[model samples]
Target: EDKVVQSPLSLVVHEGDTVTLNCSYEVTNFRSLLWYKQEKKAPTFLFMLTSSGIEKKSGRLSSILDKKELFSILNITATQTGDSAIYLCAVFNSGNTGKLIFGQGTTLQVKP
Candidate 1:
């Protein structure tokens, strides 16, 4: 079975500090690494890294994938109160059937 786990379940930081969220996974026949930000009813897609040499970036957030290590990291620079949200990492399983396996998630709180 494929599984994902994230550390430091919750975090609190000031508006100007940067934060790095970690996600590790164990899976068979990986396909893609995905990141999402959750604040509302549904999560919003942040990045998807498939190619080995490419990194996904959006504004102050960025993520990288390492197929060999079966893990990914998300970095946020100069966070703001509006940036507070739960970060999730999911792996897309590739085989006969497709499925999304997600980590528990990391909650980030940025204060003014």
Candidate 2:
């Protein structure tokens, strides 16, 4: 079975602080790893990593994948109270079947 695990289940930070979240996975025939930010009921897509050594970035948020280590990291800079949310990591299992295995998610709280 494909599995995703995220560390530091929860975090509390003040405004303008930076945070790093970790995610590791173990699966056969891995296709890709995806990151999402959940603020309300729905989760918003953040990044999708399919190759190692390439860093994907959007504003103060960025992520990198390490295929050799079967893990990924998400970095958030200058976090604000608005950045408080749950971050999710999911892995796509590729074996002629479409499946997504998700982690428990990391909840982040930012105080002003």
- By TM-score, the best candidate is 2
Which residue runs does candidate 2 get wrong by more than 4 Å? none
Quote the RMSD, in angstroms, for model 2.
0.8
Per-candidate local distance difference test: 0.89, 0.95
Residue clash pairs of candidate 2: none
For residues 11-101, could you state the per-residue lDDT of candidate 2 as single tens digits?
9999999999999999888999999999988999999999999999999999999999999999999998989999999999987777888
RMSD of each: 1.0, 0.8
* Model 2 alpha-carbon miss at residue 98, Å: 2.0
Model 1 ranges with Cα > 4 A deviation = none
Candidate 2 lands at a TM-score of 0.97
